[model samples]
Target: MSETSALSATGATESRLVGVTAALATVCIWAGWLIATRYAMTSSFTAVDIGLMRFVVPFVLLAPIWIRKGIWPKGLSVTNGILMIVGSGAFYTLMVASALEFVPASHVGILLPGVMAVWAVLIAMLLFGERPGKVRIVGYAAVVVGVASLVALKPAGVISDDMLMGYGLVSAGAFMWACYTHAMRQSGLGALEAASFVGFWSFVVMAIIALFTGTTIGDAPMGDIMMLLTAQGLLAGCVAVITYGLAVRHIGSTGASAFGAMTPALTALGGVILLGEPGNLALVLAVVLVILGVMTASGVFRRARI
Candidate 1:
């Protein structure tokens, strides 16, 4: 091979390595966010408080970008922008945050992503005519089954009355997030642009709501508040999107997303350690199925076969 060709190959390899590392960091941030959000909801913060915190920090930090691009962002359609705001912003945050008041972090982490995979694929199929292979179909089916086992079956003694409600809310939130992901893709928005767009609108919407109804901002311990500020505001809101898109750019979307298959298990383990949330057989079963299903749905195995 020519020296130039060798250098190009090395560059591609390095890019992929960076993507893999970023994906891993994004996954950890996601898991840690769930755990921290759960702790905040159960102990100190209300859903509205979490929503404010989640968007406010990012919106302030990204003020310069949104100020220049505006909320609609020059080339993005109104429809996609609305979808992005409602799906990933205050609305989605409140749904998951309220649900966290009743359910474990494991449930939020697993159910949202598992259901989201199904919803996202279905949306793509309907809107873009994207056809999933046989493997993908089976993977989506597995995700549905796993979710059913957790939500519908709900082991006898392990559930509370509000648990079902929590599950339902989180599932709805997942649908919104699926819509957001698709809208972002359809708009061709850069990761930072997308985050700023969502954060700015969410801050405005939540602020308006706070004006009318007032907020549940809490007097939580400073240490806990600082934790949420970092986890919810900075890492999950700002950095995760950028890293995830970077991963997609280098490793391809399928390769980058397959790493998300690990999040359910990571959140479950974190719940056990940090929140003292008990892990049951059903949790284990759901986590395993969802991981395998998300990985398969992401086409990891299919790519290897090809």
Candidate 2:
């Protein structure tokens, strides 16, 4: 090949590598967030308090971005803005925050990847007449089966009334996330714009709730407090969101969501390593199935257009 052609190929390969690295980093960020959120829950923080902290950290970290873009949205409507805010902001945080108190974040880390994908696909089909191909259908089925194994058919001793309720709530939270993701995609907001708006509105609502409830805010040991806030703001909030937004731009929502399926297994591993949680072989297998099923459903195996 000519030098020009060689240079072109080299650039393209670099870009692809960058995308993969960024995507993987996003997954790791998510996994760490789950673990930290679980630890933070053990403190005096209520669900809303954690939610508030999550946003507060990110809000401060991203203040420059907001300042550059300004607080006000240029062309957003009241209705769409509200939907975006409620869907992505308060409800999403509330569900996940309360969930960490009850269920292992590893469970959530695993459950959400496929759950969100299946929710988005099914909702779109039912609401908009979009249909999954045969591969996608089987993939979706695998996800359902895997999820059942993970949540419903765990060892008999593991199931309890409270655990079941927590599972149900987290599943509902995942559904809300699916709604939020789909709505934001359909809302015609630029990715960065939507992310900034989400941060802003989540901050607004979380602040309101925190003030109204008089919930204690970040009163833990200063190190723990700083660590949680830093994780929330830097890793989970700013970095993960930006990477996820960019991944969706490069790979589209379904593909990015599919790649996200690996997070649960990673989260489980992290929990085992960091939190000293027992790793069950059966749970590991189930999480693997969920991740595989999501990848299959996402059609990432198909060749990308040049």
Q: Which candidate's lDDT is highest?
A: 1
The per-residue C-alpha lDDT of model 2 at residue 161 equals: 79
C-alpha positional error of residue 171 in candidate 2 after TM-score superposition, expressed in Å: 1.1
Q: lDDT by residue for model 1 over 209-303, one digit each (tens)?
A: 77887765655677877788899999999989888888888888888778888899999999988889877888889898999899988889889
Query: Local error of candidate 2 at 48, Å?
Result: 1.9
Whole-model alpha-carbon lDDT for candidate 1: 0.88
User: In angstroms, how far off is 162's CA in candidate 1?
Assistant: 0.5
User: Which numbered prediction scores highest in TM-score against the true structure?
Assistant: 1
- The residue-level lDDT of candidate 2 at 141 comes to 89
Error of 1 at 302 (Å): 0.6
TM-score of each: 0.93, 0.90
List the candidate 2 regions with Cα displacement exceeding 4 Å: 61-72, 151-154, 246-255, 304-306
What lDDT tens digits, residue by residue, belong to model 2 across residues 283-306? 787688788888888776553432
